[model samples]
Target chain A: MIEPIVGRYVTIEVQGVTQRIYFEEAGQGRPILCLHTAGADTRQWRHLMNDSEVTKANRLIAFDMPWHSKSLPPEGFQTQEYLLTTETYIETVLGMVTALGLDRPVLAGCSMGGRIALQLAALHPDKFNGFIAIEASDFQPAWYDIDWFDRPDAHGGEMGAALVSANISPFAPEAERWNTLWMFMQSGPGVFRGDLSFYTRDDSLIARLGQIDTAKTPVHLIVGAYDLTCTPEDAKRTADAIPGATLSVMAEVGHFPMSEHPDGFRPFFIEALGKMPEPAA
Target chain B: MRSTLQTMQARLNASDHLKHLGRLFSETVLIEVDGDEFYLTFEKGAMVSLDAGPSRKTPSRFALRTDADALQKFWQSRPAPGFHDIFGLVKIGRGRIDGDMLLLVKNMRFFKEFMALGRVKAGADQ
Candidate 1:
């Protein structure tokens, strides 16, 4: 059985700008705040949001970042030079958590979102109850070049998708595959690349991972076996860097696990989310 | 067609990634378009020169062979699953890289960016 999901817009002033962010919510119980991948939006968690079992015991919330998916840019914000810095990204997430008044909400994020999740847990140790990270690493290989994004095709459609096409394994379901693929295809020029500015270059955790007390804020790292961008070895290295962080490698799926292979990723998702102490009353 | 590719040399040399990479590996890559060849000699990540046929001082490390249509489509930012990337094109039997496999593997992304310059330029062409 699955639960009906509701979508809504949140108005929050972040970094001195008023942003109308888009988010979705379903079910009720302990709150599980989900962050989506880079170059993507809240749709990544649609499967989890729809799952009856997940929504039954927990309140699931997912949001689209400014300039991503259905979320629009702040008025007067230059759309061309769009860049998401580490500081701004953190601030936005914190803004969402605070606006919702969620106490120690469990956080789950994938890829760009996943890296942010780990960083959020590490930076604000007491803010989160637990975290489920998917397809994330402190640093990724540089060869996955994205300079093509600086100059886009007639519509900036194709190259962005090509940059990570192989990351989606053939084993993924047809709908799942297209769902993930179309996100990249439809992205505005430089949107995906701007997001990568953080994913590949800006987000640094080597000096900070040691600061994360995994005992206090439980960290569950779930990665795909076929993720070329951030290999399993990379996840292992990241897990090794963090104290007491547990790692689970999902088979066959690649970078976009939540959207690409939710069924395969569900068990780990359940195990990790189920362990989080219920949200404060 | 060579003009389009030849134009990308400056963009590649100007790249922070390539400029930084050029400082690391001083190698030559031979790009064969149709039957014609252009040897891109790099010192560090900077392209010292583009020579048609062959060069006297430096020898190429590997040769990447692709046809005009494939290269043009790639340069158009067509996206992957098309012939947009070296590996993607290789998968479809549209292109091949011969010579030092390790060198190609070592600087895979660097070469990817280098090739993408043409595509970038194509995208920039209004």
Candidate 2:
């Protein structure tokens, strides 16, 4: 049975500064670290967080990155402009793992988090057990005028979300649509644009795809049919580059699948966990 | 054709959603319906100009192309799939969003609101 969800804050040092990260945990067994999409907090993983069976035997944990959700920036680390680079992002996740003492836990993330999941498995093939990437890819072929995010009178984060909301399947239920919109509206200003820099420009797993040992750290790429930004073909291409990497295209789902269609997306997510080699039995 | 363009421009000027568009400005997009081409230049979230055959001064970061009928359908009520949004139209093969993807993604809301103005005209025409 799934236990009650518990929330906590982990204080870790990044860039010679102390930062507090907000995270939620439930169930207990093999550690499962969940990361959210760009500009989105851990709320996207609500289904997995509350799953009765999945959480029953697995330690499911999700966290908000600094400058996102409740993970506010370090004291006196004042910078009006907030950007997350590949280095900063990976380092923070690694910091969490090290601090929590999770032993090569399975990593699951979507969009920006998905991008990180692929890199973590590749860079330290022995460090992670598996990689679950959703609506993510090695790289995006498009570029945008980022300065637009800094323009006066434009709320870049919210405006960016309106575009992201487009990724939601038109058939999404009203509750799911409102829930997604509420989270998007609550995100910190300019955070979405900052996160996209890492997702869209900074991180690319193409060159390092061969470095991943799928036999050890299996990779599963899941894309939704309605996620036009990162099409199913994109995930297929990324999976093909990595030997043994598996790809699944969900029907009627979109970019933010887990939350937008949690019940519908649960089975596919569970199947991914099923693929993970039993943790060091 | 000119009447449609003028209607779109007028609606853009009156829209509170489009009037205060942030980070989405400083972009000039070329709109091509059939062989008719023109540019919409945005600055600080407001549509500053709608000129003939694109703007030489600002040029166009991206261009959209479709026939007038499709454009009309896009402008009218979005009661069906494939005719709702530009990306939707692109997905169903009715429209194309090409050139400078950054502008397209970063300023997408600006575009969406700009197009959704068609709802007003749809009500008027009916």
Candidate 3:
């Protein structure tokens, strides 16, 4: 059977460079903008976008960042190395929001996306209806060496997939687990390291947590029970720091929750949506 | 432990799990659990040797070394967060790896499947 999702591209200028961003959308009503994890694409949200329960009353939108998937890199990309920073990341998301003319969309992201979600809550809470930061923490020390991710001798595809496979819960369906790994394996050269540059070395957001006014924009922090990278403990610390932030630890799920096991992730997602304050009438 | 490794070797050779992913993976790898060593040799994705070791004569592409407690936790059906993946073990300081990392990374899927056999064998023995 054919799915209801629609794919489209929008041209937006981010960091003084023009980029043609690819995004997929399904369903209708309040907008839910999704941001994929480091080195992954929009495919991570396929299951969520197809769920009738989610789409019937809400719209799900997922976009591939520049240099990832169908979204081609900006001009002069080949000459210089690709490195994502907080400034560039925020501009890209905001550029998309403005280009799409979204009305107070609920911003949701995983891992690197999750980190940016928290960053937005602290810096641009007024732009989103609510925030869902999955597998994120306020301050995560460098985990994997960047050299190991992209280098001359190591095969980027195999190394990236193998390193990430451990984050998948043993309970995740075998097919979905492999599917998640397959996408990681397909990432472009240096893309994984470029994205991780933001995740691992970004300035700490510890002090900024207090600035999030969850009353205006509810903050929901969800983490997988099996995410060794951003342990539930790390997310909890972030949640506690935010005055009204809510935290949920999903069992039998890992870093790639929506992709690795959407069935396990659906209930929690619906619940978070239920908590979203009704948009201004 | 010797018998367990033998059973693991037989299982790896019989399963089609690594069919497409292991064609070029021919290497000898070493595993050291709390100082007790086991040398495993894979020939074109099939286990050819499961040598229990004290001898330093056999060369390997790489070695994964961790304590017995860490191995026990990793072999659990539902391993703890930090022990679930080999990298996770290293990240949490419960494990160490040395030698040709590039070779190991290239044949990572093969090695991961090879290591996961411990979980299955441990469960079966229970």
Maximum-TM-score candidate: 3
What order do candidates take by TM-score, descending?
3, 2, 1
For residues A156-202, what per-residue lDDT tens digits would candidate 2 score against the true structure?
Answer: 66666676776776556659866876777777777776777777776
Per-residue lDDT over B7-53 for candidate 3, one digit per residue giving the tens place of the 0 to 100 score: 77887888887745677887888989889899988888888988888
Candidate 1 chain A: 10-residue stretch with minimal lDDT: A150-159
Model 1: DockQ against the native? 0.04
Q: What DockQ does each candidate score versus the true complex, computed on alpha carbons? A: 0.04, 0.23, 0.56
**Global lDDT of each model?**
0.77, 0.78, 0.88
TM-score of each: 0.70, 0.77, 0.93
* Candidate 2, TM-score of its B chain: 0.82
Off by over 4 Å in 2: A1-3, B1-64, B68-84, B88-126
Top lDDT model = 3
Error at A147, model 3, angstroms: 2.3
A1-281 in candidate 3: lDDT tens per residue?
99999999999999789999999999999999999999899999999999998999889999999999999988888787889999999999999999999989999999999899989999998899999999989877775577677877667877888988988997788899999998888988899989988888876688889999999999999999888878899999989999999999997799999999999998988988888876787
Worst 10 residues of 3 chain A by lDDT: A140-149
